[model samples]
Target: MPAWRRIRSLRVRWLVATLAAMAVALVLAGLFLHSLFQDQVMRQHESALTLQLDQLTARLEFDASGQASIDPATLSDPRWGKPYSGLYWQLDEVGAAPESQGAQRSRSLWDDRLHPEPDSPADGQIHVHQGTGPRGVPLLLVERTVFSAETPARHWRLVVAGDLTEVGDASARFARVLTLSLLALGVLLALAALAQVAVGLAPLRALQRALTDLREGRSQRLQGAFPAEVQPLIDDFNGVLDRNAEVVERARTQAGNLAHALKTPLAVLDQAAAPSVTADPAALAALVHEQVTLARRHIDWHLKRARVAAAQRLPGHRTPLAPVVDGLLRVLARVHDARHLDLGADDMPADWAFAGEEQDLQEMLGNLMDNACLWARTRVHVAAQREGDRLVITVEDDGPGIAPEQRQAVLARGVRLDEATPGSGLGLAIVADLAALYEGSLSLDDAPSGGLRARISLPATR
Candidate 1:
């Protein structure tokens, strides 16, 4: 199989899917958290720069020539006096060229001047921008346009620019920490998922071992209790094993029985072939015929039982009871037409069906109805009804019925109540055996019409 097709393992499938989802979710969560942190940090940086800008505006001094200056000692922050201290302030003409000379600036600016993006801010309105400062360091610039009363005609832009290196460093450190934390969390969650998959599928592993035991003949059936989720499957498999054993046992028994049944005929034939035996040709032929017929009967009986047993295991064997009964009644009516016997079936629903092969049903019902016709004086009645999951069929005849004590004996193989009735004495026995194969029962009861009632209860489909 291809590599993809080989991924039929349920455990592998679940783990891969779970890990993939966790990875995506953790990555997204890390990104969202980092973005939020960056925004808050940027907001705080802007607010600090705005405060410095406000102080610079309030302490500004302009000469009569509209030149602006500030008292360095007046600023409380010591960084304003330190060169390249990352915090700086400068003043510029509103629409001057980038390098306007004599523009007042803080000592922190040193030789480099702040070049903020050109923007016409309304009076007292602050605007923020990103710019570069000394040594190509990134800076966040917060600027405001101011009109001093000392130099109202000459508006100067007051700007405070702070180096963003520290903020970038802080954010980088936070990103690294967040990544490590989320990776750790993902690892823990993955381990948890792995453990859960192992625990959840443990029952399947047990089931596999049980199957191996059964296959190896270490046990007769699957053994051991399982989780509720897997218990039903275990039960069904065990049931199948039991049924298979039953089939094997039945086959063995039937073989032995058939052998035992044929032993007498075979021995008789063996004795007849002896040199010491002296018999006329007609007598010899008659004896051979009788023994051959008896062997054939035993063979047919075992074969019918085997066929029914095999059919019992198969599914979807629905034979409508009404149709089979009708067909059998038609056949038996003609077979016993000389007696002018009343052979008919009681009113049964057309949907009443037997859960077995049609041939098996025919064999069972045919034997019963045929026996009833033989002994019936005036009427042979066949009726069926549904009792829960069972199909109850009763064949009754209005004639001299067998005694209650002889009913069970009559169902035994080759047990005929009346030898004068002219039968192989296997009809009722076959019916009883066939019914038993279907997990059904054959019973003899007193019919309302004062005849022997052969009642059969077989599994039904509808």
Candidate 2:
């Protein structure tokens, strides 16, 4: 049950396989034990028959009448008890009737009808059968044919029987013993299997402890002994940690370079204005404002890049895209309040996600929507939806559409296609940079509203 978590593991599967194989071996061992015990029972039964035969051999003798007879008194013995008293013997001379030997013999011989079947082999060894005896007690019977060495005419068959009840009782007891023993063995094997599973999973528990230590900020890398089978997995995990650290360092370096690269131009543009003219409230303020806005745009672009880098290393609940785009339209409406434009966020699937940092998403959509607000005279529409593995956000307004040749130049850094346009023209360039940072893209196209449509696409993740 503990293994049923989302972090699926192969350890449980391996343990189950080991248990199954052990179970098979135990079953086979029980079978072997049964076979060995059964063979022992058969040998004891044959030994009883051989002992009865040996006694009859000494008792067999010729009387003065020249007839064969057995001394019945010899049948009684201390070692030979109840069921062994069930033995029978028959002796017949040439052309004469048969005579019984034992007092407690089968009543079958009493019938004088007690006759050995001809089907018995001449070699005379133990043969198993079921036949009625004198008392009508069902019997498990053993028979043997015999020959006398002194007289060839003495060809006799010795048939032995024991009560079926005694044999059946003995077998039942043996079976009960075997069953109980096998059951005990199965329980012991099951416990052994459980212990093997625990021993085998010990490494996994150690690995978990190591990872927990890492989460508590105690260790940066896991180093512990593990079975050779898991060595590759540990090595691969270490490699991932190393790569993540490298990516973090590279992101910081690139962020610093971006800040330094854009500051020099803003400095020069500021120095170009004279101090007396810069002191003029209207004209100099406008010049300073434009340059400050350009510098802010560069800063925002790099900041978005840094946020995207951080989010890649640690993903959480997906950032909702519909609300982010909607919020941007509302703020853009407030920014261009004087124009009195009607901005509506088009309905999109609410579950669409951007999968990047929430603030970076806000910056990307805010810049695009603000640009739409700047150019539109009456209406601006923003919407986002998914296509395949990408989520596409499009902002459209009823403004002059970009000429086919000018669309490419509009995305270039510091390339303002329209000089009369009030701003520094870095908005589109910054949007393009942020898009690239998240492995996304931005494109310019004709809008259905008779204006430019800025479409931005970001990779979709669940």
Candidate 3:
């Protein structure tokens, strides 16, 4: 089939939908958690920078010329004295000439001056921003404007900054771990979804097997207690089977009643036209006899057709081939004993069964074996075997076989061969018709023993 159709199956659709939903949820959660963690980390980093700026403001001093400077000796972190330690402090003279450079900054700044934006914070207020620090590294800067005691007339922009590369590395590491963990969880959940689908739909698989058994004649109805969700379906199917069996039984009774009803009148007509009635009644009696016989034959033919068609669909019909063949051989052997015919049936597997009623089996096999016995010079052999879902039965004899060209013609009802054989020519025709009703076939071919071989094929028990 096509790829789309295969994917559209219930199990596949269930697994896809569940896994898709989980993946989306995991992705969104990962993003939200990562953003929350980054925000908290940045907040903590800013608080530390604020504390360092406060200390820098405390350490602010001026030389004898009113120039603001920081006493590096008073700072707690030794990195403030180390160049490019990723932690630095700087002071810029505000409200000074645009061309004037800032006051001396912490030793860590070296030649790189802290560039405070023109919009500096109000006196004693703080402004936090991210910008380039010494050596072009990213920094989180906290700047505060203060009028130092020694230089009270001028506002100095005091700044303390820390490098952000370490924090960024930490965040990146966290994101990678979070993604891997969530992906692992998703894989586990996908497998759980598959298992859930299989468990949830297990009843459906059981129901399918039960139906198959019913069709194959291994069971009469759906057997086992199903879940409540599926119990009603099984009940309805069993009800349908029961009703179908009832209907077929009714049809069988009606066909039997019809045969008896019609045959009685036909027999009466034949009796009424008997030669004992009058010497001149020969011609009239012959005509009446012929018509009565035709009516009876037609009635029997149609009744059997109707009965077979009705019973073919009813469930729980299995006839063992070996038993039926054995019975037929015993009866026919006695019936044709005076002809000294060698009649026997080959052993077939015990499980070899025709998927139909016993009467139908008897009917088909009887006609074939009887025809073989009638024409056989000495021996009539019968054998049966199973071929896949079909049963194959062969009846062969050593008598003169029908010519290939005329074989097809003999299958027609009332078309007797060899006027002296004393048959209505309906045996093979009836067998063929019954086999066709069972969705089977019958064929005539040359036998291994120089006689005709009649092969019948019918649906077998699964």
User: Taking the candidates one at a time, how many backbone clashes does each contain?
Assistant: 0, 1, 0
Off by over 4 Å in 3: 1-5, 61-68, 148-153, 277-462
Identify the leading candidate in terms of TM-score.
Answer: 1
Lowest summed lDDT window (length 10), candidate 2: 99-108
lDDT score of residue 412 within candidate 3: 85
Q: Is candidate 2 or candidate 3 better by lDDT?
A: 3
Model 2 bad stretches (over 4 Å): 1-31, 34-44, 47-256, 259-300
| Per-residue accuracy of model 2 over 1-462 as CA lDDT, tens digit each | 564652365655665676788778877877787777766776686677667766765666764444455665566653333333455555533234434433234333554223444454454565666665546655545666556555555555556655555666676787788778877887887788778778978899999998998889899888899899988998999899887887778677877867686677567665756464335567666777777776776776667667666565365737888788777777777888899999998787777887777777787788788888878879888877788978898999899878989999989777776688777677888788778877799999999989989999987766
Q: What TM-score does each of the candidates earn?
A: 0.89, 0.51, 0.56
Instruction: Report the C-alpha lDDT of model 1 over 53-132, residue by residue, as the tens digit.
Output: 88888898878888777888899999998999999998888877666832788999988888888779998899999989
Model 2 residue 83 lDDT? 34
Worst 10 residues of 1 by lDDT: 95-104
lDDT for 16 in candidate 1 is 94
How does each model score on lDDT? 0.90, 0.71, 0.85
TM-score, cand. 3: 0.56
The alpha-carbon lDDT assigned to residue 296 of candidate 2 equals: 79
Worst 10 residues of 3 by lDDT: 97-106
TM-score of 2: 0.51
